[model samples]
Target: MDAATLLARLATVIDAHDWAGLPDLLHRDFTCRLVHTGEVFDRDGWVRLNADYPGFQRMHVEGLVADGDHGALRARVIGTSETGAELEFAVASFATVRDGLLAELVEVWADVGQDAPAGTRPQLT
Candidate 1:
């Protein structure tokens, strides 16, 4: 599959929570980096992390773009915490593909509802 198709399929597979399908879409040397947490994971580790994530409800792809072997995606993830709090997160992912499979992925994630920094800007009326 081309980069765009591969990325689209990836979004679909993730949203469907098809952990078993992740391996098929990833290269043998696949690696994932979590920018916010400063963590790195190989294919097996990444798959296990996602599969065992706490309160993973679903993910929605907000935007996606690809150029040749590189792709980027913006996604909204929803879940309920162990404390019964509803949670939402915004995630940005950059990916590189090799031989039609995802080879490297770097992701940054943040809570969706955080306010701007105290002195960054005045609130609009």
Candidate 2:
């Protein structure tokens, strides 16, 4: 599969919260960086984190760019917590693919304010 196709599949798997499907897309030693928290996670760790936040409702892939064996995707995620409170975030992910599997993923994400539009620019004071 091409990088774009793999990325789309990854998004689909994540949207479905199908933890079992993740291994098919990731390398056995896959590494991920959470840009906001500056934390690094291995494949197993990634699955564990998602298990804790299983309420993701919607994910929109806004853009994708590829160069050689590397690519990036921008996505908007909207969801409600287990308690029913709404939440939204924008995520930019950089990935490296080798032989059609995702070997690494570095993602930066931020919480979007409830009153803000999906891609609105933040106001600075």
- lDDT (Cα atoms) of all candidates against the true structure: 0.92, 0.85
Residue-level lDDT of model 1, residues 1-125, one tens digit each, is: 76788888988888899999989999999999999889999999999998899999889999999999999999999999999999999999999999989999999999998988898997689
Number of the top TM-score candidate: 1
Q: Which candidate is the best by lDDT?
A: 1
Question: What global local distance difference test value does model 1 have?
Answer: 0.92
Please give the range of 10 consecutive residues that has the lowest summed lDDT in model 1: 1-10
Clashing pairs for predicted structure model 1, backbone only: none
